[model samples]
Target: MWNRPRFDLKVRLTLRVAAISAACFAAISAYFLVTADRAAHARSDSIAAIVAKSLELQQGKVQWVANPRSDFPNLDPVAAYVMTPGLCLAFRGPGGDMLQRFCSGAPAPANPPPQAFAAFYRSLFDPGREAARPVVVRGTKLGETVVSVDPAVQTAEAWHEAGRLMLALAIALPLLCVLVYAALARALRPTRMIRTGLERIAANDLTTRLPPFDLAELSAIRDVFNHLAQSLDTALAERSELTRKLIALQDEERRHLARELHDEFGQSLAAIRALASSARQTAAQECPSLLSECDGISRTATGMMETLRGALFRLRPPDVEELGLVASLEGLVAGWNGRSRGETRFSIRFDGAFETLPAAVSANLYRIVQEALTNAAKHAGATKVSLELTMRPDEIALAIDDDGRSNEPAAKSGMGLLGMRERVAALRGRLSFEAGPNGGSALRVVIPLEASDRQLLDHAA
Candidate 1:
């Protein structure tokens, strides 16, 4: 059972409104009930006073008689004249004996109140309370005129009044809740857009921004969100520019280093080899015993020259802009194939024209491929490697797959992969290196071209 409490704003607001309204309704009902109780008591007192005054007048007009029943002055007329519904009247002699009594029978209510309500009403008010006034004439005390209001009648009246209020409350509460819910839903609708904008930001799309909102709070959030996105976009743009400059500077430095090595070291090694050759020739002519030592020196110098050439090739690759990206990559694959010497077969597949590519993109793409191939060859020790480059209208994709040992741990921590990642980030591209399900690993890079570059490629295609 999923018993998590609902966190919906609309629902919670609606419920809170309902609770406060119900409390207000209860307060109103209590006030009405209290007012009704006071009114009921006052009406009973008024009836008693009127009946007592009428009795006094009637007795004063007649002669005094002590007859209990026959000379009771026919009190029925006074009772009848002063009687009202829910009212009761009684007269008792000075001896505490009832002489005459009249009650205006309170009619039964059409719809009685509930027992619970009746009990509550009775507990709050004195239902059996009565108003009494003494009847006296000629300085002689007569029986008391007692008047009381019926409890059942009072309860029925209170119930009717309260029932109407309850009915009104019952009808209005749901409508009020519905209105509140709808208003809250409309006010909070902009939250969905905010969530989507945040998601886009998380996905590295700093250009995503929220539109203006009518509510002040939401509008403030929109302003802050747009400002943050703008700041991030600016920051990322600056960072990428810096990274590109750094990469360009790194390449320039490597080229300088390679040039110096080729100039100074190349001349020295050539001189040494020339010296060894000349010494070997003289030794072969004069003393053939020294020929072996001369040959050894020449061989050693030649091996060192081969090592230096390999280092120079890696340090300063061929110019990608002059030869174009496609030819440069083809040459790269051929060199790798030749170096592997059939131990690992390297292949390249190109889908679209690469001649019109921007120089920066061409350079970064070449470096990323170079780093990936180095990892595959040196780290993974793959036997067969395939490189695929596809150019679409909006983006370029390069995938390298090799049937070799998975070097995922090394790929994650190696400087080569780090350099590749930095180059991809500078190009605002995505890079992924993962082990294949069955065997080796696959490295994929996706770089989206700018509008101008895309247009150039389209025209060239």
Candidate 2:
């Protein structure tokens, strides 16, 4: 299954900061845009009012021309005094009909769109250049003068302000994010260090510990982590020592029992064999029927001795160190196949160099394979099994697959699989059992030459 991508603390923090900054800048930019447009409109209207009022008498006397000129022309005083860009003078009758108009540089519209007037009311506190005033002379309204704020000029101003704001944000955001991320990463560096140390402890490296930290809170955490690691190391050491003593005692007891069985039991069997032989000879003459019974006793005693010898060998397999793991496993598979029933077949394939492996590794791996085969025979109900032994540059791997239906519940609690796991765990390796390719059970083992790169080692702490 695919999983969604997860953002780390740094990424999440940076994105959140950027969002907040953008929101704040957006609000500020909006306010400035509205305020600037209103200021521009008001200033233009005030200028238009003062210029129009100065020409009050001249506008009142203007009469309609008898013949139209080639183009509408401004008188010298009107042109000289009121001619300006986006500003003009219009003389209108009592009925609000235009009579004559004066242009400073460019003529203003007689009536701008309703949209512009609507925008002015909405920005009532800061309306753009939409101003109208009545030109009155001697209490008679001559015409109405209107000035509209140039939309282009207002747009350019807003653009400049917005551009500056955007530029500032663009430069500041990255720098701010970098500063924040660096500070946070440095502040939390202790946590990462502590986590790494815990993983080491989990991997059985009890010596692992967090480094010293500068901040008081982090320093305290580091100290606690170090103490915890120390406690775990001490506990693991004691447990390891106890386990070693117990294993040594167990091995010694096994060897002693084997020795005693050979010395005492072998002698008793030999004495019995001798007594039986003597009885058979006597029986052969005294009672011929008794001779058969005596011969049976001799044969039974021989078989018992043979079984005892095999048991001893099984308790502690011989030629392990001397014959090495490959030869040992070969011997093991041969024995299993010989003893198996129901058309069962077992095979083993070994590859790569095994000369550099530690004796403990070889021995444990041998036991693991032995246990797996035993499971296959007794529990897996397999008809065929195959083992693959391989070596890669960084690791050694062992795989055993059998064509037998698995009993999963039993497999989990099985001593054989448990023992295999214990051995692999001790070696800091990975071991697993699952459904086989041939609809049976598979045992997989991978032991790294060095410590495996896994975060799971943290659990050791």
Candidate 3:
């Protein structure tokens, strides 16, 4: 089932205004119609009384006994004064026969109201109600005068009045809706800015802030949004600082551990291998059978030494600051290629100068590449890996693409990707890992340079 479409604030408010206006117009029209009905009834009664009084005056002046039917005063003059559109006057003799009747003989209206409206008005007010007055001359009943207003005439008048009101309403309602919608749109225009600010914040731009607004409610929102942005920016800065320090400490600890292992285990293993070789040489001729045992010991010591060297290389990578970022990365790729021994191909592409890069950025970039390469080798089973580092005026970008099995699951759950994220976060950068175009996966990192870095680059250029 489809859900009902929801209108925005401006449209909803305009629609509500229109509804209220229509209701009010209906009420006003009803009241006007009722008032008109009462007025019409009062006018009919007054006309009846006037017509009765005129008849009595005519009776007193003329001799109804002398010529009862022949000399009855003419009611034409009275009808001229009392008769009007939708009105009629009548007089009946004592025998209940009509003696005189006068009507306005008004024509039917050109644009008559609908039958429904006429029926409804008649039902409410009974517009055909007659006002009757009995005429008694000298205690002898003469006739009765009756006056009535036409139902159609009264209904038509009420409809015309209501039509005027509806005409005005029809003309004004659309204008009213347009004005209301415009006012609401102007009032809520700041919402667009708020939305943009929120989008920036979602994109990890903690510095984004909403400016002060003219409306009190919008200003309050601005205050809250700016305060929240400020808090988030401060928190992020503190977190980045903390992460940088932690990473520095970790590198220091690794260096110390690597140094200790090299000094203690490395020296011991070298000594054992040298002693075994010496024993093998001496026993080659002295005992002949002990030669195999001596050779086995030497081989085992050599294998242990090789394993320790690999561990040491990972624990304490070459100093990025001393070796330079480009050289360090090149050496790292070379080391990986040497280890892969034709199983995988590793390559690097440098686009711009990195001599002025910050030490922290350089070190983190080196470590990120190292961890990415390790994941590609162990988890992704990549056969070909390529690294691209570009130093632009505004930002530094690093992309690592490999042709291998997709490592998305391992990337999500592995510590290698997490470490890469932390390093990127510390530099206020973005990290994205997704499937490569051809096959396997691609990792991308972008770190915008600070104002000072940009200025330095400009000066260098």
Candidate 4:
């Protein structure tokens, strides 16, 4: 719509061109004005000199002719006039009394020109004023002859010449401007295409590209845009993958919880019910077996309570808050080694500031070590295991190694390894699982104690 904002490039170009053209025209006009004024002054001076000389010569002849007794007294001053064989106008003597005057059908002389005729008449012949040459003639003998050459006539011719110059400039300047505009538009053509291409792009149209720009400067920008688009696309893909993984993990957690509740609680309830029914049926007979059954039921209920509490603690350990990480991890290792049946001996080592670690760090590291041991117990098939948990400068490191062949070649779909990866990633730690020196799986993790994160945790604590 006409009311809408427009990005028409031609308008800008036209403004720039008009400014340049106007400057050029101004300079040209100033130069011509100065040159024309100088030329006109020069022409006026030349004519004045010619007229002065003619007057001097004619005066000499008049003096000779007036002296009848002198030689060549009959000679006519007219014969000596150079420009047209006879004077266009003539005057008698130097003092102002014109004894005689002659002209070729021209008007009679006006009284007499002033003494300084050249000075008085200079403005009349000025080029800037009008296109005219006014010539004044005076006699030195009878004091003068004077003539005024009508500049109106001479100026007409000069004006014709000035008109020709103006015409040429008017035509030539516009042609030059057109040529310049064409060249500028051609040079910037690629830029316009690039702008249009950028405007066409949106989130849905990330695949679009700018026209192939060959200019080195422009190509760099094009490459940068392409890289940004590609990076965005890659990041989006990774986020999508992570989202799918998170959903699966949540579902698995729900299933595990459901199973644990059913298997542990359901069996305990059924056993307690059966024990109670037996006690009730024997109570009417007053038998000793009924009392024994009641006692067994009491012990069974106590054991079930203990087992349920243990399972719940495993799901989210309360010991993490009360006993801290060192006590918790030591307890976990002792339990694992006690249960492990194979020749794989588990050893635990620790070094550096265990007690001063932030609670969150302690919790995550404990979980990582627990998971690593569980994995080794279940899958590594090793005979001996070594665990090193240490804190270095600004960092905490955990390593678990076994002495049997590693299962590193397991498929990527294996959730145990995948879960380890996720937990390590969440903690912003590095994780590596590979064959150890003795061909067993060695899992290592390192987490930095970033000062900012430490400060945040300390504040929270």
* Candidate 4 local lDDT, 1-461, one digit each (tens): 37977665765676687777767776775566457556755654454345445555554665668554433211134324422212233343434454444433333333333335323334544422321222233521324333333333234434444455667768876786677778777766778766765665542334557656767888887787778767765665576467446744754685578568657785776678677767766774787666666767767776776666556545655456688777888888776676675455788989865665766567667766766766676666666778998877667788888866575444222666676676665555678887777677778888878787566545554
lDDT of 2 by residue, 177-221 (tens): 888888878877777877788788776667777777889998888
Candidate order (lDDT): 3, 1, 2, 4
Worst 10 residues of 4 by lDDT: 127-136
For 1-461, candidate 1 gives per-residue lDDT tens digits of 89998677778888999999999999999999889888888877887777778878777655554542335435677676767777778777788776777766777788899999999989988675988888888778887777777788878889999999999999998888889889888988999999999999987778898999998999999999999999999998998999999998999999999999999999999999999999999999999999999999999999999989878888888898899999888988998898888999999999988899999999899999999889898888888899999988889999999988886567556999999988998998889888877689888899989999988888887
Per-residue alpha-carbon lDDT of candidate 3 for residues 1-461, written as tens digits (9 for 90 to 100): 99998879888899999999999989988899889888887887888778777878788877646655655646787887777787878888778787877777668888899889888877887877888888877887678888887777877888899889999999998999999999999999999999999999988898898878999999999999999999999998999999999898989999999999999999999999999999988998789999989999999999999999999988988777888999999999999999999999999999999987888788899999999999998888888999999998789999999987775578545999999999999999999998889988889999989999888877876
Clashing pairs in 1: none
List clash counts for every candidate, in order.
0, 7, 0, 13
lDDT (CA) per prediction: 0.87, 0.71, 0.88, 0.60
Supply the TM-score for candidate 1.
Answer: 0.68
lDDT of 3: 0.88
**Model 3: residues with Cα > 4 Å off, grouped in runs:** 1-7, 56-75, 90-149, 287-296, 338-348, 380-386, 401-409, 432-442
Against the true structure, what is each candidate's TM-score?
A: 0.68, 0.63, 0.82, 0.40
